[model samples]
Target: MTDVFETDDPETDAGATVLEVRFTGDEGRLDRALALALPDLSRARLQALIAAGAVSLDEAPVRQGSAAARAGLYRVAVPPPESADPEPEPIPLTVLFEDAHLIVVDKPAGMPVHPSHGHARGTLVNALLHHCAGSLSGVGGVARPGIVHRLDKDTSGVMVAAKSDAAHAGLSALFARHDIDRSYIALTRGAPHPRAGRVETRLGRSTADRKKMAVLRNGGREAITDYATLRVFGPDGRPLAAEVRSTLHTGRTHQIRVHMAHLGAPLLGDPVYGSGGVSPVVREAVAASGLTGQALHAAVLGFVHPVTGEALRFESAPPPAMQALAAALSAL
Candidate 1:
């Protein structure tokens, strides 16, 4: 259950972090083993680096899709950390609050938080770069310089970014401790069985679709979601859809949407999870609201101030599309 590694030695050639790992664990994928052996690097980042052919085992190149990394010594060559300073663009940003340490912004739907493979421009980070005027922090490395957490590209609501490394660390710890208060409002097909309840599931990459997440049976990470039915819309006296508010105890990708879908109540307009066969009323509401993505909104966020040691809470009204959807539902 322990990984013995020697990686602090200087690189033999140019910029490299030569790592010699004798993994003692017999479980998990090679990427998982590497990620566990090197806790400093994020699992996702380690997977990316491994997939990029940056590692070797026993003088043989370690394939990114290698079956597993067993109890064996391996050599890993880590290249120099990539720079995160993407070009700053004049992307509009909605600042909700700001100070020397951190800034809160109301991020719009359809805007990615940071740049990655397909999305190289017009991200929130790009806007922050332009607006912060060289004050952006670099503690989070290249993938996410000041990003503490993220919302999906189609979800709109409050998001906070760090201005200083201290704030970034504090916020990251808060998230790790699950001390931050977060709430999301969503419109889902059908009412939940209990009207309000907790959903505890082990989440992992879906076997059916690698791009999506699923409640897995084995070797998955723990995920917890709590939701309550706020209102129900069933114009013809049959339950069609409901407006629900959810609190996340653990943040996994698409946790709420996946859990709700697992409850047989997929969020309205969710292209990935939805069955595309909702009742006429729900369909009409979703279509008329101008929502081309999931009908979910991050409505409330609360946490302690990283610098000032003060409690803070912020609330945001649903976006226009959600507002329209709510109005349509209420009228039914």
Candidate 2:
């Protein structure tokens, strides 16, 4: 059946181009019908659009691609493509050190390092673009200029950015060689069985959930973490929570969180890897402390200056929420 396509010239909402399609008879399947109607868009893209609720039938949102196609008016809202270059934003940064080649800042929790699919603004890169005033190195490309490494959006702590191309290369080399010293403080339920040791494993994307990282028996990359239990709260024999310190020898995506979870000591408030029951006291403390995300902080970062060859080390204490949670846990 031939479908009539009506294109809207003006973007009426959120920079999305709206296409109106009218079907006269059943078209077998919605995705197949949409793909035939919108020849420019791939069938896979149409199916994704339908799943994302960007396609509507008779003004009602359509969420399933396999739904039967009936004679009706279908509206497809195609979102605009993201910009190639990130715009600078006037967001405040806690600068620890700054010089001709590099800048270090105490990045707070909840701030993403760079712009991504759902997060297009209010990122560290946007703030640094404004702070550096176009002086940042372009080695990491336009999307993430000067970013040598990254911390997860919800993991708070020290981060260094390169201001010069030489510094960027040097810092990247240092990280690649595992010469940089990185330490994190994690508040975890229970504790590692041995209390202090090294966790070495192959880490990769989870087979079940592609969005999350996991420990793999084969394949994947090598990830190593040297951890020690700093302190445990609650009862002596059966502690409720413990403060753990992890030192990274090899950096991988979500390395610390996944390793800790594998060791039966996932970080508190970690939404992805932290699963299992928590004590009522700990739950109450978490609510009271206002710790919304994972209780993992990049407590220390030490490395030789890439350009100057001077030793540099920066340390940051946990944020207010962590401090409050620790206090509450201690009192238990």
Candidate 3:
């Protein structure tokens, strides 16, 4: 749907305009409210604009965390126009493996693997588009040309994209069979009593929060996470580190994060999961490490070659922050 703000003149380079709007419907999202008033942009773009502090209500910047507005007369302000031309930034990427069939990339945290919503360009896909040129195979959509699977925008990990339809089919089958080996390294608040275990639960969308996933028994799909304790310690000792290697029998949204939180060991810096209760030591360590998102990294990926049928394995070391956390935990 179109966003809440629009201008009569698209070419107008006017600095900013004040728009008066009246809220309708039940207490609606601020974005929705704005989009209703401004219909030219997409909802995702509006949210990004809001997050970027480009949208102001009644001359005040709208806070992204604030509750939605009820019936009201609101004055909305729009930011200056952005450049229409998109330039590909030469962002560094870790190449795990590359072949005629597909390419496996060890994506870093905070990088969107592909273009979506407000992130239309300068994504990993865009980079691949430039790097691979005519080599990338066309998938179902125009935006996602070679994409097979996806990692979340903030979750850094190894991901595979096909170069041809045959490769895509083969990789899809392997994924369907749960043959792809995916391993992640994560730091948690407290150590589990057993130190190693498996979590099998049904996961579904949270009824209260649309942005989050929750473990549900009634109607959720089954999800599983196999975890091993890489290291364990008390408060005076080291912080706990866990190696969670998950094979998705069924890929539910946020499966690992939700299941881990259900086990009371949410990943560090996961704002949606209470930050794992943030111990003083952990908090201090995390702050010192300069991590802005969850302390999770995809460490290993393995699968049979789509065309060659040869077993292949790719591994990536944790990013700097994750490595520092590991070092601190080791000393503890």
Per-model TM-score versus the true fold: 0.74, 0.92, 0.78
Pitting candidate 2 against candidate 3, the one with the higher TM-score is 2
Predicted model with the maximum TM-score = 2
Candidate 2 lDDT at 183 equals: 98
CA lDDT, every prediction? Answer: 0.84, 0.92, 0.70
Candidate 3 per-residue C-alpha lDDT over 198-274 given as tens digits, one digit per residue, 9 for 90 to 100? 88888888899878999887888788778776766454344444444444555677776776778767877788975
| Model 2 spans with C-alpha error above 4 angstroms | 2-6, 9-12, 22-52, 65-71
| lDDT ranking of the models | 2, 1, 3
Relative to the unseen true structure, what is the C-alpha lDDT of residue 276 in candidate 3, on a scale of 0 to 100?
45
- Residue pairs with backbone atoms closer than 3 Å in model 3 (clashes): 3-35, 3-38, 3-41, 4-34, 4-35, 4-37, 4-38, 5-38, 238-332
**How much is 38 displaced in model 1, in angstroms?**
32
Q: How many residue pairs clash in each candidate at the backbone level? A: 0, 0, 9
Question: What lDDT would candidate 3 get against the real structure?
Answer: 0.70
Which candidate has the top score in lDDT?
2
In candidate 2, position 145 carries an lDDT of 96
lDDT of 2 by residue, 1-332 (tens): 66656566463457788888888887888899888888988898888888888899898999988988888899998888889899999999999999989999999999999999778999999999999999999999999999999999999999999999999999999999999999999999888778999999999999999889999998999999999999999886888999999999999999999998898888899999885667888989988999989999999999999999999999999999999999999998
